[model samples]
Target: MEDNIKDSKQLISEIQSQYTRLSKGQKLIAQYILNNYDKVAFMTACKLGETVGVSESTVVRFANTLGYSGYPKLQSALQELIKNKLTTVQRVEMSDDFSDENVILNKVLRSDMDNIRDTLDGIDNEAFQDAVSKILKAKKIHILGVRTSFVVAQYLGFYLGIILDNVHVVRMDMGDAFEQIVRVGEDDVVIAFSFPRYSKKAYQLVKYAKEKGASIISITDSLFAPIASVADNTLLVNNSMASFVDSLVPAMSVANALAVSVGMKEKDDIKDYFDDLERMWEKYGVYE
Candidate 1:
């Protein structure tokens, strides 16, 4: 929770740190954001400008003054600040424009496409390659995810387990999840998945693993995410916020890419392993 608050405050701090240098109109914009960020997070540039009694161009310039490419980017930062705080009911209310049945499907699909594109544009390739290398060399691999992120962790674990004999998907069903990875050491790696609303337990697990000397690879939506601070390698992915239920397509794509990359690297070994398994499965009529 402390890290989560820090993450939210980072943008506010940036705005405050830069407030003195801003023009009067920009200051008006900033003041409104400082006072009513939750409202401004959903407002368009034109609407924000109108509320601040400035021209729409002023809002755009204000965002640029704050180092964002445009108002949308600034708005995105504001949304990130409050995303974890928003309730399911709040999200549904905020996304009320989706009520139009004719455009909802296309709107959702297009939003997902944009999410993947943005993620591709922003992902750090060097970090990604480093994660792959570390995974292949680790003596043990522990993967953790809960809530929405659990779906992706499971997908990654299922494939990685088949390719490598060292994969362990941390189970949160009964006992303490921390107890499962208590012996994590320098030779091991911990891959954690977290997104907004970020999971507190996931961050704690990753933090604990880091303290225990394990290499950490984190997949999350922001560099400010709690787990990112503990990660040896961090992968960023964009998730669609068009509706109450955030789309996991971009995160899922990154997980798929990791699995495929690892599989490709161990193709020769996996080939024989799969062939033997296929023979056994056929003998037992496992596939029907």
Candidate 2:
């Protein structure tokens, strides 16, 4: 009944506090839900029963034991917990009522907006400023991502190139990524973007960059992600709401902020670079 016992960890602790009171099947259900809260948020009572190796009726009873009126109510609470913790895309997928397209669309949009708001609230300004500083100091900055994240990497690279010097957006085939990573050195930095169903190539790039003494700044889904293991600095993004789509609005916002911070740090350098480019354009009629 503690107000603090709202999340999965607290929920698990609550179960533990009452562990001695639970029946055999209810105990199994509790253990399964505690261990797999994320999975349980998206599963039905029958499916959860199968997962916990308990009868469907036992699943309902387990929910009742947890103070829910029924399984559906329990599921709703679990879903809400996940909604609070996961990304928009992740929350949509886990949600039970996906039959209506309009409902799903509304939920997705709302969730995405919530994600952006939450990210802004949780972002460490000092850490972000440090990342900007590292990027500004690097001789070369490589932006690397594969698959769906490639689009984000490319966009960041394009915008950064306009405002900073020596920004390389590397999104060729994975085979080429290895060659490119090898060219990076201690004086460089690699800003990597990857999410769930994360790319092995991205992981390799992180490893390769680390081995070559380049600083790695990663934007990924969670602290548990493989990319986090090697990152000198990490920005955690939530993308867990929906199904397969990786909603990138929040990631894009973060990238733009970083770019703006870097530009502001090197305002004079950026202005001079743009001035030189404009002169070259005018002299060569490049725009025409």
TM-score of each: 0.86, 0.70
- Across residues 133-228, which tens digit of lDDT does each residue of candidate 1 receive? 999999999998998888889889999999999999998885989889999999999999998888899988998899989999999988888999
How many angstroms is residue 19 displaced in model 1 relative to the true structure, after the best TM-score fit? 7.6
Model 2, runs deviating above 4 Å: 1-18, 23-39, 43-96, 272-288
On a 0 to 100 scale, what is the lDDT of residue 100 in model 1? 93
Best by lDDT: 1
Clashing residue pairs, candidate 2? Answer: 88-241, 89-241, 89-242, 90-240, 90-241, 90-242, 91-241, 92-241
Query: 1-288 in candidate 2: lDDT tens per residue?
Result: 422214334565667787789999888888887787877877879999987798999988877776667786676556545543565566556555566787888877876887788678767677687788899899999998888888889989998998876998886764577777678999999999987666788898888899999999999766556788899988876554554455787898898898888778778888898898899999999987
- Model 2: lowest-lDDT 10 consecutive positions: 1-10
Residue 116, candidate 2: Cα error in Å is 1.1
